[model samples]
Target chain A: QQPVQSPQAVILREGEDAVINCSSSKALYSVHWYRQKHGEAPVFLMILLKGGEQKGHEKISASFNEKKQQSSLYLTASQLSYSGTYFCGTERGRQGGSEKLVFGKGTKLTVNP
Target chain B: DARVTQTPRHKVTEMGQEVTMRCQPILGHNTVFWYRQTMMQGLELLAYFRNRAPLDDSGMPKDRFSAEMPDATLATLKIQPSEPRDSAVYFCASGLRGNEQFFGPGTRLTVL
Candidate 1:
């Protein structure tokens, strides 16, 4: 099943911080975070593997909670370029080292200078 | 950097016509996925293939849409007798198992 994202939309100042949450009912082996600008394709940000690993890219970080079946993305000291829609993709179990991903509806974020 | 490439970045066609979108997955990325995006549905997975073999197409509309990986490097999604409701941005992504996906600049299809 596709995960559910909270705070469908958020607005933040350029230097502020924001958090986006994604929750799934089923177990997820991996969770991926991506950002998409309007009229553009989504760009991969980071990936959080199972076992509650934390992955960070620049000021963007994410944590995966295996027991809770949830993941959260943290944007610290956001920049104007961070204004975009954020999506979380989750995969069930690994299948021969490959698995299909289900994506959430995405959280729209806007950063104002 | 090798990235997923999609053809016909923008297309506008009349209803009932046929539309075809193609993708070239990244080298050695065994998993390929096709997704449709719109304001209402956000992003919906249409189909996927692993190692050139179809894994799941349950999200696709079998009646009018068909997805196939004719070869390891290429994946295609086709819609016959297209309707206005099929208008959306279609994205193609490729990745290794349990890793970050690389997305192509999607094909924007508009069915009038």
Candidate 2:
């Protein structure tokens, strides 16, 4: 089953902060986060492995809760460039086991300058 | 800066025609995924291959759609007797260790 993302859409001003959450029914080994702009493909952000692991790039970071089967992405001091749609993908188990990924409906964020 | 590459960025075909989309994954990436994006369904995983072997394709309609990886470097998704409802942006992605998925620009298919 596909993961569920909360807050289908949000609007924020530049320098603000926002959080996007993803939850899955099945146990997830890892959660992948990405962002995409209009008329463009989704861009890789970071991956949070199970076992309470965290990964980040720049001002974006994410954490995965294995027990809860949930993941949250934090965007601190959001910038105008951050205006885009964010998607979270869940993998059932470790790599080399399954190549399939279930993605959320995506959260659209609009940051105004 | 290696990236997944998809051919025919945009394809427009008549109904009942055959449509094929190709993907060239990043070098050394053993996993490749195919997804379809629509307004209602968002991004759906159509199929994926591990070591060029298809693992699961339950999300894809077996009758009209088929996905195959001919080699480590190439993968293809084909649709026969395409219909208007099949029109959507098809994206190809590649990843290592299922960690970070790198997506291509996507092929926007329009069936009329």
Candidate 3:
């Protein structure tokens, strides 16, 4: 099933902070975040595995709550380059089977100068 | 750096025509996925394969759509008698088991 993303769209000034949330109805084993620019393919940002772990890259970070079946992406001191559509792909159950990822509708983030 | 590559970045065809899209996954990756993106449907998983073997293709329209991985490096998605509603950006992603997937540039297909 497709995950749900909050705040379908968000506009922010450079250096501002924003949070994008993704929630699933089913239990998730991992959550993968990606950013896609206009007319471009989605780029991998980070992946949060189970165990309620948090990961970060530069000013971007994400937290996965396995128990809550939710994940939140944090962008601090956002840069103009951060303007794009962010998607969260969720994986359920163990690996080795049909480990296909179901993605959310995506959150459109616009960072202005 | 290794990256997934797709052929025919853009394809325009008339209705009832046949369209084929190909992908070359990153070396050492065992899993390949095909996804279609549209304004209404968002990102939909069409099919996926692991180690050149199809794992699941229930999301694909079996009537006109087909997906196959002939080898470890090559994967193909074909649509016969395509319709205008099939117009969308198709993406190919590859990854290891339980790892982050790397996506290709995507093939923008427009069925007129």
lDDT of 3: 0.92
Q: If you superpose only chain B onto the true chain B, what TM-score does each candidate give?
A: 0.98, 0.98, 0.99
Instruction: Note the Cα lDDT for every prediction shown.
Output: 0.90, 0.90, 0.92
Q: Kindly list the per-residue Cα lDDT of model 1 for residues B38-67, writing each as its tens digit.
A: 888878889888888888888899999999
Better of 2 and 3 by lDDT: 3
Candidate 1 vs candidate 2: the DockQ winner is 2
Looking at model 1, residue A56 earns an lDDT score of 42
Query: Per-residue lDDT of B1-112 in model 3, one digit per residue for the tens?
Result: 9999999999999999999999999999999999999999998899999899999999999999999998897999999989999999999999998777889999999999
lDDT by residue (A6-104, candidate 1, tens digit) is 989999999999999999999888888889999889998988888766554766777888999999999999999999999998888776654667889
Model 1 chain A worst lDDT window (10 residues) = A51-60
TM-score: model 3 vs. ground truth: 0.96
Worst 10 residues of 2 chain A by lDDT: A93-102
Off by over 4 Å in 2: none
Model 2 interface CAPRI class: high
RMSD each, Å: 1.7, 1.5, 1.4
- A8-95, model 2: which lDDT tens digit per residue? 9999999999999999999988898989999999998888887767665866888888999999899989999999999998889855
For candidate 2, the TM-score is 0.95
